[model samples]
Target: MASRYHEVYQSWKHDPLGFWKTAAEEIDWVSTGEKVFDPDQGQYGRWYPDWECNTCYNCLDRHVEHGRPGQPALIYDSPITGRTASYTYSELLEEVEAMACVLADHGLVKGDRAIIYMPMIPQAVMAMLACARLGVIHSVVFGGFAANELATRIDDATPKSIIAASCGLEPGRVIAYKPLIDQAIDIARHKPDSCLVFQREELAADLKPGRDHDLGALQAEAVVAGRRIAPVPVKATDPLYILYTSGTTGQPKGVVRDNGGHMVALKWSMKYLYDIQPGEVFWAASDVGWVVGHSYICYAPLLHGCTTVVFEGKPVGTPDAGTFWRVISDHNVVSLFTAPTAFRAIRKEDPAGAFIQQYDLSQFRSLFLAGERADPETVNWAIDQLQVPVIDHWWQTETGWCIVGNPVGLGLLPVKPGSPTVPMPGYDVQVLDDAGHPLGANTLGNIVVQLPLPPGSFPTLWNADKRFFDAYLAEFPGYYKTADAGVIDDDGYLSIMARTDDIINVAGHRLSTGGMEEVLATHPDVAECAVIGIADKLKGQLPCGFVVLKAGVDRSHEEIEKELIKLVRDKIGPVAAFKIAITVDRLPKTRSGKILRGTMRQIADGETWKMPATIDDPAILDEITEALKTHGISV
Candidate 1:
């Protein structure tokens, strides 16, 4: 089917407020006030500031009241514990009501902040919805974050209550969360009033006498009392949640998501952007800690009246590479959204996709990849294996939804292997040079979205409007600087090549490490790869590549390294000066699967650097350093 993306985009371009106001009606708004947008409200204006709504009501009660009470609303699948649970819309609303009553009984009120630190469980979703029910602004720090890192968020958000769990499970290990929460509370200057701890069967926690409360025990008590709390109405512009960006240092910065616009945008995305409809099973196989989990996993699916999966397992090693397929097949999932790193991992384990054949994916319609630039090799590999339209979309934590994507429902545009397709309805994406001048089609330049960034994007940093302006808006004047370097083709497809910092200069020529990584991915034996610009005395900077080979590849590493160097030189030209390809076990990545390229560059240049708070494993950096040492390039 041919896409009407151009028609819809033009409509949005012609009248942004009218487009959003029409979309806003899809949600069950408490009061759809007159002003669709107020341009003078914040750093770059505000969306639906006067509109009043309850995010929790749209996600839960509305579906139940509209004769869909028996439909499944949330599914909890935990391969680690071999446990599965499903909740109907009515059942989920009951649980959220009980939890909200518990919170209200403990004196949590509208606008008071709460922090949720829990694993991927039914309780975590309940906590978030319950907070939303009472208009408490909640912040979710990823389960198992370091004590000091959690402390930084505790100081920043300064929640009055904390909802957490005892432990989080990995394939071969159990991460104790209670101790980390305790330690964070100890380190932070601001102390939360109470801590609600959920005890997993694998590991129980020791609750503090005065302040700590058992979550299960309190929730049971609330249910016994028949406490049913109604969803509190809040101004559309009032904050729904605060999500601290994953890869950060020093002081933690929290991006605030507004209740009204967040509901309007995500609900619209479910039908138009994702093309999944009501009552279908939609699974975003991401942890609730990140933005993907917040929007797709927790909020969007529920708002759209779809059953959302809360998966507690890895892409592999939870059982095997077949776990993902099993979950999709078992749940009758129609759409699956995950990061590209997951597919690469599965591809590395089962290159032939033999595990995929063991399950029936007749109901699965499409696969969406994000969280990083989806290299063409990985994208093509997924297309071949799944025989589904593998879409590569791009967005960020601040935006809360897609900036550039293929509107699968509006009808997908022609697939471009590397580009994320094009800017979505709300974004006016452009490529601009250093001086803030617009660049022509297909020119490598800074990617900026012309402000005011549509509904659902963060308006400002929590409690730091000046810092938000300085960090995002001040640099580009009227545009919100994405800080990513990319090219928009003549057809308007946006190709995210790298972060602005990742664009390196070789002699006098600007080059993209992402472009080189794409070339390296084409190598048959390379399972995963990363490219960084290393400092060089003669050329100012030289390209350095690292690769991890596929399983059962018996070819010599030296031979593959030589091929990779030639592949980049041939594909990107000699101006890249591509040299130094090293074979490593893995590339350093954040917990969310973003390669730590900037950190790798810092190490190669012998610059002092602190350990990233979001590093997947601190030990990976040691492996990277040793691999660099072999190539005579180390700090």
Candidate 2:
């Protein structure tokens, strides 16, 4: 069976187009064409250029048409709101149809854009499907974003309408989103024609008369009026969604995903990479704003006729450290996917694994990690705790799906600690030098994808074609520059070292901060840690690390710092020059749990840096700055 998988991979490498044509047959398309890929039309390659289809129909209606109407489609688990709901295929189809009617009734036509800012609820999924059904492009912003961040996305997308909820229930509070939407509209230069609000009733929020309309009322009205909205067929190359990803600069880059190719590629990934079958539950603990949620949570699983869990709770919050375990056991989630940061948090709260052992995780088959590089410590911890194959995969927002992963469906490969295993079938991944030349195995360099990005990959930046070319394609003439620095071993397994910028040059030798961070994370007392390259007059750059200790660990700062320095020196080498290690209460991170190393570096270097809107806590920056100052570093 594993050989069969390898044979398929070899076939894809031999003939990419023919490989895709076979994959494209997995989904229902209105018009399938011979043209597989067109690289000349756009600087970035375009796949399934001459086909036409409606994504919502492929995801929702087809299952119903095939007599699987009672099959589960969406399993929503919102522990924060104390709500749990399930939607069958037929029920979801009807809801999506009604929502499409509501969109049409609001005067939203084909090619229009709608911005969705809602929590992880069924309505959010409905909004996305409704937009796709009507040939309207939807851009989903992370619900945790601030008003100013929301305004920036609004300005960039210039959406015709905004779909949002009045409030979302978090662990200790009911956060009103309607006010934020109103404030974002007030701040944004491009005003929407209308706003559709879902009143959660958890908090009070005033609704305007003419512009703001109730989402529930609109759906009810559509049903009462006997409005029948059919799926609007769009060309294969038509835009599906514009997902904005944060860049190194302040501006966010809107990545555009199209209809036909995206449907094919994602549908393929659900079966091959995730090993999820139809009717099985697949849970990805991520937000809709991120690409992982867009691919796995919303579209891919559904396209494969599987039940995708829309979880609206934290890994530790909605009660205790056993939240994820309870969710997995209660929902019977077969394949669990989440971030390493989440597991780290769980490990921090329950180091003895008592909470996890309380629940029966027999239904769980595999545990997948992404969103950041998974440290070997976290990977091993999860494997031991869960007693399952804990897999780490690497991908980006632009790619829209996993590029390198352990193919649990095909056959589980030998687990490599801190590596994302191997590339998937469609991708030809390589390590390239600064001059775009291929490097030998074990040599660290730029990770590039040889020409012709597979289907489901973003072809261009939304409304910024030249910028896309210059940012991604221009760096390597025929390959897509991933902007990640990494090494591929002789076994062809890739270990993503760090973002090229995160690679610190110390006396001209590149040192991976992620590598050192991974080593530091192995310490039993450490909860979370981040390493940043600080300016040094002697070696050009020096590694400075900040660690968050586990609760109840009463180790002194001096002792912990001394132990960490010696650990790094012994594990990595004396040449690593990892001298400074600071014990901090917490590392500054985003709501999604990515450490703000760049911001930390800025504060340490005394460079002017704006407090990012996505930061989870602003005070942590100040705390880090004060710690740096106390260490005799001139911040």
Candidate 3:
């Protein structure tokens, strides 16, 4: 295994195109064709049409054929109900076959789409794989989204059916997901033909009047038939999924991706970036909805034929913040991939030895941090507390897996406090100015992908190919504009500063407004908050925070400001402890729950904000302006 990995590494380092082509041949393709690059094709220039492979075949059948059918493929845990389950590869295949048979029984055939609004459970994974097996594109929405948001995605996809769980577990709550699904279906102008419901906490009291099917009944009824739905013939470019990205207007962008490309990208990523081994149990703590989970947790690990842990609950549950450690102990996970937000949350609840000692994490070999920025404090905290190398990676929904990462030790050459490390092999990443000229090392500029979009990069926007290209490609010719501000240090290590819209340089140290907001929200009294760095003489720029207290909680100005600073220090580091952290009544956020940091920045910098017509709460801006003046931070 080591020798093969070495060959892959050397080949990739020396000749990326040749290495990827060789890796491409590892999978059984439907056809063999070669068109890796074509500059004239513009945004959609790179197409590999000569190859074809179903994700299920690569993830399941191939592994089973290699004499590893009985190996455990998945382990799941639900903290709320205290339930646990496990599935071996063969057993998982059986579940997928059974679910596929059920779908086929309902006349849903190949080329159909299925929207899965289910919780993090074995059934959810099964349904997804079953859709893959049946050649039905699956789009999964986050279970916590409001009904309107859910309806928009469902409408966009126009799926034939929805596989939903009755309920799901969050921190200290059991969310009724089925009811949400019902509400969405009612609000949806275009509804699916059927609904497959899984009962976890409580059965739906009022089922939407339609072709409502109980998952348990269907599984039980189909088990005796011993039938498997025949796999469909799929091309490499056939749409495999339509992952909806959150949009500012609540209308999500359906990120359509192909099966073969996703397989190639994810397989290579897990093998190279994460060094995934067959027997290893990989645990990416992100929910299945996000891009990270879609790649690492669900698709990537399976594509590599490895065991994975899928927790059907949140990281922080009751019993005083020892939930994640307990899950790791129970599952004996070897690798953990989680967000910096989760790690910070754990630290906020308990930053001592007893909580850390409650579980055995010695089995872990690597820990990956994504879904947000990883500053020095978070990195050092993981290293000191968990005693494992924390790999901080940078990527987006469009780029797919860790295009830039510090691969275990070989790439972990040196650590920069806020840098996201170097780009991985096969990625030609660059930082360029607005005029498309490459910027010098250590010069902050727009991050751009110099090469064509790689595998797992969205094949196209659903019904909006022109819009997709115009948004990503038209901004810069022959490059994919990342819209992220970054800097390549003198040492050639890549450090992502922040989103260009929200980044602020304070004392020469670039900070993400999102990162500061996350830290401020750590205060017990703060229910929500936003932060923006305003101009300052001494520091160049300093952060000014706007905080919203939890209902029925009263906090004084000095107390809130002090707590916010301390929270930033404790969660991140002293560098994040800004000199001007203040509290406000509310913040200006987009309809999709993202804070309008640009507007806040303007407000902090003493500039008038031209409120857009769609501002959800225009009054919030006035409140923020008044509060800042009241706090005596106004210019």
Candidate 1, residues 489-565, lDDT tens digits: the string is 98888999999988999999999989999999999998898888889999999989989899899988898899888
Q: Distance from true position, residue 96, model 1, in Å?
A: 0.6
**Candidate 1 residue spans exceeding 4 A from truth:** none
Whole-model lDDT, candidate 1? 0.93
Q: Give candidate 2's whole-model lDDT.
A: 0.89
Model 2, range 138-241, lDDT digits (tens) per residue?
Answer: 99998757888899999999899999888877789878898889889999999999999887768656889999999988897776776778899898899999
Candidate 1 residue-wise lDDT at 519? 93
Q: Candidate 3: lDDT of 408?
A: 59
Candidate with best lDDT: 1
Q: Best candidate, TM-score-wise?
A: 1
Clashing pairs in 3: 31-50
Ranking by lDDT: 1, 2, 3
Give the poorly placed runs of model 3, Cα more than 4 Å off: 1-15, 34-42, 409-412, 504-530, 533-542, 546-579, 583-635
- TM-score for all models, in order of appearance: 0.99, 0.98, 0.84
Look at candidate 2 and tell me the lDDT of residue 14.
93
Model 2: residues >4 Å from true position, as ranges?
Answer: 1-3, 224-226
lDDT of 3 by residue, 1-635 (tens): 12243344466768666766766765766566666434455355554665666788777877888987999998888776677888888888878888888888777777898988776788878888888888899998776567877888888888899887887666555678776787888999997899888776544534656577887568767766787765676877777888887654435678887877678878877766786787788998877777776787778888888888888665455445688778787787877888775665565456553587978887877788876666565567677888877788888777667778766534344556566777666567898877889989888788888656777677578877888888788888877778888789887788766688677777777676766765665566765566778888888887777776655565577877887777777776766547566666556753223467777777768876566322446888888778778767673
